[model samples]
Structures are given as structure tokens and as C-alpha cells.
Target: MCIQTELQRFQTEFNQTLVQTFSQLPNDIAPKLHQAMEYSVSNGGKRLRPFLLQIMAKVLAIDPKLIQPAAVALECIHSYSLVHDDLPAMDDDDLRRGKPTCHIQFDEAHAILAGDALQTLAFELLINADVQTDIKLSWVKILAQASGYQGMCGGQSLDLEAENKSVGLESLANIHSLKTGALLKAAVSMGCAAQRNLSDEQKQKFERFAELIGLAFQIQDDILDVTATTDALGKPQGSDQKSNKSTYPSLLGLTGAVHKAEQVFQSALEQIEDLPYNTQPLMDFAQFIIKRQH
Candidate 1:
């Protein structure tokens, strides 16, 4: 099947799972809080992090059922991050996925609580997963580290600190690697961890692939911020420039950033070349990451 067709199939199945899971939430919860959580999670986007996790599970020959909870948990964390990231104290954005942002649609306090609830709900889903204890523990650790101070949160702090201040390429890369790359890498890592007999070497290779693509993904995002229209991005174009935050395009010129993205993308492809499993899907995903308009 074509890559686009395959992605659509995965996305459709994933969406059903998400809806089903959300529907199971207890009616006792505060109605507005529940609605806000549902709205944020249901807001449309590519669902790339969960897609990466699911695709890696396929490559590793892990059962989709065994990994489904993890996929959902990853997405919850991603969505929660977006909710918090768009707050008045943060990016102060008014739109997401072409719709009013959580804070805009709801009040700031509710959006904050909704983000908190979604974050806790992520771990709750993982704890209730039917997978074995070790795998569950591993997933928890991977996700917490990726989302916590050592990873995404730390990256966000660095990014905020760098605003209106000139930062070098290395500093900018470090910021993005933690801010954007950590969770993406964790998605791949969690999928690999699902394989009972995965070797250290195999795990390392998959991780390297994730790291390269994560960097490329950020570079492509930076490129698109300058090139794509607001309609295409479904968010403000030039927001990065407006915020005066350092980015790949800011450090490297636009031409240089594009070149860098391609270079990293090719490196990611090479990482999967010698793996025992068929890596065509992963390669296609890497292509999509670098080539995507938004």
C-alpha cells in the first residue's frame, strides 16, 4: 500500500481507540473538566508520536494490542503538553489545529486543570494496561523522563530562556533535542521495549534512528514556520520569529536549515538499513517527517 494510505489506515484505527478510551471516562468527573480534556485530545493533528510508537511496534513484531495503551498514553502526554504550551504564560497562542486553543475555547484555569488531568490520565492508562509489570514499568520510566525536567520540560525552560537572546547552533540543537526530540525518541524506545528479547545493539540502532529523525523533524518545522502559510500550518506562521526564539532557521540560514534537515534524514534512513526487520514503513515515516509542510 502507498505510504499515505498506510498512514491513513493507522490514523483511523488509532482515532477509534482514542474515542473508545475517552468514552470510558467516569461520568462523576466534573463535566467541564471532562469536556475540556476530551476537546484537547480530540483536536485533530497528525498524531505523529503515537504513529511512531505504533510503527515501531510493527517493525518489532509486537502485538498492537500490547502496545495500544502506550500509544494512547504517549498521545495524552503530547496533547497535554500542547495545552500547557499554549497558555497565556507560555506561547500565548490563540489557535491549535486550526481551532481555538484550549485556553481560548475554555477559561485559562480550566485549560490548566485540563492539562494537569490529561497528564495524570496518561500514567493512569499505562498503569491499567494489560501488559506485564516490567514492560509497564519501563514505559512509565521512559515517558516520565521524556516528559519531565530532564527532557521536554528542561528543553522548554531552555527555549524560554533563549528568547530574544542570540543562541548558537549547538545551544539551539540542545534545546530542541530535549524539547521536541525527547518524547519522539521515547515513543520509539517504548515500542522497542515491548519486544521481550530485544538486544542492546538493536535498541541502540532504533534509538539513533529516532534521534536523527527527531532533529530533522524540528528542522522541518522551523523551515515550515518561514515557508508555509498559516492555513497550511493550522497555526500562526512566523510565530517563532515573532517570539524571537532561536531555531534551526535562525541559527542556520533557511537554505542551510533545509540542507541540514535532509542530511539528518538520510542518516536516519541509514540506521534502519541493516536491521533484521523490514524498515520500509519507518523509512517512509522519516521521509514524511522531513518533507511534511506542517
Candidate 2:
């Protein structure tokens, strides 16, 4: 099958599974707070992390059902980051997925609280999920590390510091590797961790694959910030430039950014080319990151 077709199939199932699980959260926990959590969590994302987890599962010929906790964990962490990132203290974005941001749609305080709750609930899902204790512990540890100091938060701290400074390509890559790539890397590793019996070498192979694609994903996001329109993006475009944020395109130029993304994509694909299966979904996903207008 073609890449888009595979992606579409996964996206459809992932969305359905995520929504169904999200809806199962208790309604008694302050309905408004639930609303905020639901609003942010249910807000549209490409569902990239969980999708990556499923793809990794496919490599093992494992049932995708086994990875629900990991998938939900990915979505929760992703949504929590967005909630905090859009706050006045952060990006101050007004729109997301074609709607007002969490702070705008809900109050700023609720947004903050919701983000906090989501972060905590991510661990809760991992612990309380109906999985083997060994697997749950491993997944929990990976998510905690990825969403904490070594991952998204760490990256954001660097991004905040680089605001007025001229960040070089290496620094930019480092920041993105942590800020964005960490969770993506975690998603892949967590999927492998969930496997009943994956070889250490197989796990490493997937982890390496994750690292490559994860970095490529962020580069594509940076390129889209400059190349895509707000309508297509479903959020304000050019905000990166407006904020004077250092980006690949700004530092390397647009043509150079595209070339850099291509290089990263190829590097990612190279890690797994010796495996005994087609890599069309991964290839398409890499291309989708750069080729997408939004």
C-alpha cells in the first residue's frame, strides 16, 4: 500500500481509540476542569506519537490493542505541552487546530491547571493501565524522562534562552532534539518496551529509527512555519519569524532547510533499510513532514 493510505488507516483508528479512551475519564472531577482537559486533549493533533507506537508494534506483529496506555500517554503529554505552550507566559498563541487556544477557550488558570493535571494523568494511565507491571514501569519511566527535564521542558528552556540570541544549527538541533524529538523518541522506545519479548537489538533498531524521524519531524515543523499559510496551518503562520525565533529556514535559508530536512529523512531511513520489510509508512511520514504546506 501507498504511504498516504497506510497513514490514513492508522490516523483513523488512532483518533477513534484516543477519543474513546479520553471520553472514559471520570466526569465527577470538576466538570469544567474535565472540560478543559477534554478540550485540550481532544483538540486535533496529527496523533504522530501514538501512530509511531502502532507502527513499531506492527514491526513486532503485536496487537495494537496492547499499546493503548502508551498511545494515551503520548496524547496526554502532547496536549499538556500545547496547553502550557500557548499560555501568556509562553508562545501566547491564540489559535490551535483552527480553534482558540486553551488559554483563550478556557481561562488561563484553568489552562494551567489542566496542563498540570494532564501531566499527572499521563503517569496515572501508565500505572493504572491493564498491562504487565514490568512493561508499565518501563513505559512510565520513559514517559517521565521524556516529558521532564531531559525532553520537552528542557528544550523549551533552551528555546526561551535563545529568544534574542543567534542560535547556530548545532544548538538548534540540540534544542529540537530535546524539546520535540525526545517525546517522539520515547514513543518509539515505549512501544518496544511494551512488547512481550523483543530482542535488545530489535529494540535498539526501533529506537534509532525513532531518533531519526523525531528530529526530522521538528525540522519540518520549522520549515512549515515559514512556508505555509495561516489558513493551511490552522494556526497563525509566520509566528516564528514574528517572535524572532531562530529556525532552520532563517539560519540556513529555505532551500537549505529543505535540503537539511531531506538529509535528516534519509539518515533516518538508512538505519532500518536492512530490516526485512517495506518502510513506506515511515518514508511517507518523513516526506509528509517536509512536503506538507501546513
Candidate 3:
């Protein structure tokens, strides 16, 4: 199937599964908190992390059901990060997914609680998944490392520290590698783990692919911040530039940033071509990262 067609089909199926799973969360004691959690997650973005996992599952010929929990867990973590990222202390974004951010829609305290709950819910889903205990344990460790100080959170800290400061391209890459690339890399790892068996060489190849794609994804986001409209982005466009934060465009210039993204895209395609399985979905995803309007 064509890339867009396959992606659209997967997006619809994943959305249905996600909504159904959220509906199953209990709401007996803290209805308001539950509502806030739902509100935060219901403002869906591209669902890219989970889609990466599901695409890997498809490539490996694993049953999609086997990876559903992991996919949901990954998305939960991603959404929680967004919730916290949009907080007044963070990016201070007032809008997300074309609606008010969680902190604005509800309250700051509730938004914080919702982010916390969603993070924990991610681990809960992983631990309770039907996979073998050892596999689940491995995945939990991978995800924890990805989301903790060494991964996304650490990256955020670096980003906060680097704000309004002159940072080199290496520093910017490091910041994005942790803050954005870690979870995406983990998504691919979790997908690989869900597969029956994969060689060390194969896993390394996938890791390389994820790393390249993660950087490319962030670069594309930086590009979009400059190129896309607020309505198209669902959040304030040019916020990064407004905040004076270091981005690819800020450091490399818009044309240079576009060139860098293209380089990464080409590298990703090379990685995909080396894989044993059909890699059309992965190639399409890589292209989507650079080519998407928002």
C-alpha cells in the first residue's frame, strides 16, 4: 500500500484503540483528575511515537494486539510530557491540539496531577501487559531510562538552562537527543523487544534509524515553527524564536536547517534500505517527518 494510505489506516485504528483504553480508566474517586487526564490526552498530536512502535510491529510480522499496550504506554508518556511541557513553568503554552492547554483548561494543580497520573499509568500498563515478565521488565527499564533524568527530562533541563544563552550546534543536538530523541528511540526499542527474536546487529540498525529519525523529527519541528501558522500547528507558531531558544533554524539558518533535515532524511532511508524486512512504512514515516506541514 502507499505510505499515506497505510498511515491513515493505522492512525484511525490507533485512535480507536487509544480512546477505548482511556475509557477503561477508573473514575470512581477522582472524577475531576480523570477528566483532566482525558482532556490532556484527548488533544492528540500525530501519535508518532506509538505509530513507530506499531510500524515496527508490522515490519516484524508480530500481531498488532501484542504491541497495543506498549504503543498506548508510549503515547501516554508522550502526552504526559506535553502536559508538563505546556505548564506555566515550562513552555507556558496556552494552546495545544487547537484547544486550551491542560493548565488553562483545568487548573495548574490538576494539570500537574494529570501529568503525574498519566506517567504512572504508562508504567502500570507496561507492567500489566500480557508479555512475558522478563520482556516487560526490560521494556520498563528502557522506558524509565528514556523518560528520566538521562533521557527526556534531562534534555528538558538542558533546554531550560540553554535558553537565552549561546549554545553550539553540538549542544543543541545533545539537548534534542535526550529531550525528544530518547522516547522515540525507546519506542523503537520496545517494538523490537515485542518481536519474537531479533539479532544484535538488527537491533543496532534499528537504533541507528531511530536516532537519525529523532533528530530529523526535531529539526522538522523547528522548521515548522518558522514555516507553519499557529492554526496549522495547534500552538503558537514561532514560539521558539519568540522565547529566544536555540533551534536548528536559529543556529543553522532556515535554509541550512532544511538542508540538515534533508541530510538526516537521506541517512534514514539508507538505514531502512539495509533492514531485512519491508521498510516502506519506516521510509514513509521518515519522509513524513520532514515533509509534514505541521
Top lDDT prediction, candidate number: 1
Clashing pairs in 1: none
Where does candidate 1 stray beyond 4 Å?
none
TM-score of each: 0.98, 0.94, 0.97
Better of 1 and 3 by lDDT: 1
Q: After superposition, how far is residue 2 of candidate 3 from its true place, in Å?
A: 3.1
lDDT of 1: 0.92
- Candidate 2 residue lDDT tens string, 1-294: 765677778778877876786678877868988889888977778787887777777766667888887888888999999999999999999899899998899899999999999999899988998888999999999999998998899999999899968999899999998998899889888877877576787677767877777777778889898888899889898888888989999999988988988898888888777766555555666667656666
- Please name the candidate that would achieve the greatest TM-score relative to the true structure: 1
Ranking by TM-score: 1, 3, 2
Error of 3 at 259 (Å): 0.6
74-178, model 1: which lDDT tens digit per residue? 999999999999999999999997999999999999999999999999999999999999999999999999999999989989999999999998888899899
Per-candidate local distance difference test: 0.92, 0.84, 0.89
Better of 1 and 2 by lDDT: 1
Q: Give the Cα error of residue 76 in candidate 1, in Å.
A: 0.4
Error of 3 at 243 (Å): 0.6
